[model samples]
Target: MDWEYFFELLLGGLTRGSIYALIALGYTMVYGIIELINFAHGEIYMIGAFTALIAANVLTMLGMNELAVLVLASVVAILYSAAYGFTVEKIAYKPLRQAPRLSPLISAIGMSIFLQNYVLLAQTSDFLPFPSLIPELEFMEPIAHIISSAEVIIILTTAVVMILLTLLIKYTRIGKAMRATAQDRSMAMLVGVNVNRVISTTFVIGSALAAVGGVLIASHIGMINFYIGFIAGIKAFTAAVLGGIGSIPGAVLGGMVLGWTESFATGYVSSDYEDVFAFALLVIILIFRPAGILGRSTTQKV
Candidate 1:
């Protein structure tokens, strides 16, 4: 029972959890608003990472400062990811809004596959090395040896983004519209809340958050590939389900729980079962509390 070793695993879990939380937010938000699971959301994260990689290379060729390159590349990646989110909704989803539920589900899966191949062709099927933009910090030599600047950035950035999202939803007009639409789309439309705009905006915001997560994760891990999204997406989706699919706070909680489970499982148990641990947790949650940790049971009026 080494305390230091245990704490090291805990910090690693937190960092991974932050990335999962960001990706899970996209899942929960879209589900919360439209009750549609956008399976392609994970591909948007993958694209963001690739976009950032390309942007970083271009900036480096221009001899930009390291900090400037990181900042600019992240911005470009976020914007591109947001555009993809917006386009996917408009082209694939908006048309089938009135179709059967299964239609959209299948469409989402198809889109996810298409994006994977699209990247595989445009880029390479092989894993690409992600640029290391996060500068190393030597300032925290005294506190603990396990903690690093990347972990600190991941945690702090997640906190700030979550807080900003909360404030946006609570105080902003568009956020109010989103909430209204989420509660009841027909009623929101009756009250002049633009449901279409709200949904698109939701996708944009969610995609941007995912982009940030992708960038941070690429920097943390040092490499990425087109297929990275599939596994990460599934795990994030599981976190969303574990936390209560449509609940924002639940998504965050579920991600942290999943991360901790994986961290401890790998450290004490075996890395081979890291993913098994996540899915097992999901199955247990579904069996005991289907609605999720923070999810509430609902009754239909029909």
Candidate 2:
């Protein structure tokens, strides 16, 4: 059999899952903290990619090395995305913190539309080419045909980020505060946890993660447009739901599952049905495991 082709698809799925996990983590984190979907999260990812593209071009024009350019671009993207996330929370969400859930959801949709148009008018409707920031390694030359250096970097980055994030959530002071806030916001506040800061921090962290994903994926795909975030955001949100929206580990697992499903469908079936299969998988998961693969089913008394 075509074992080589099988491995190629496997690697491809792994890379796709990495990006999805990064973006899905944001959705799950925000939902875990505030129980809000933060619909504009995808636009933040798009903005991060655009910011990285601009930074990379400017650095490259000045003759900066690819490594330096990549580092600077990633930093700029993360900072920019984080600031936007903070501002969005303050402007679009904070004032309505006590309002009906639908209020913020509508506001989120509006914010997303505004960001998309802002980018369209500020940048261009055309797709922009993104430079490859991952350096090639001599050791990977043999297996490069099955998985490129960029894919390797993407997967490794995701793993490192996941480990670091897990540590942060488990051991850091702010991490403890976050867990406290998520468990009981009112009680957390009573016990001296800054709910507001925790919420903002959650947004910042989530946005930063998505920005990293944005840069990595844009580099891998070679081009990006303004609306790329919308599709990616929807898929990531699906991953969050599939893995359990309020569960962090679930987001990672759901993303990997979704990515593999899409990859196999495209490789064995047809490219046109890739999304169809992905969403169909989501439907099946929802029907059987309504709380998600790792999400717990909870009931609230009226």
Q: How does candidate 1 fare on TM-score?
A: 0.97
TM-score of each: 0.97, 0.97
In the predicted model 2, the residue pairs found to clash are none
Over the full model, what C-alpha lDDT does candidate 2 score relative to the true structure? 0.93
| Range of the 10 consecutive residues with the lowest summed lDDT in candidate 1 | 136-145
User: In order, what lDDT does every prediction score?
Assistant: 0.91, 0.93
Find the candidate with the highest lDDT and give its number.
2
Over 139-160, each residue of candidate 1 has an lDDT whose tens digit, in order, gives 8656536887777898888888
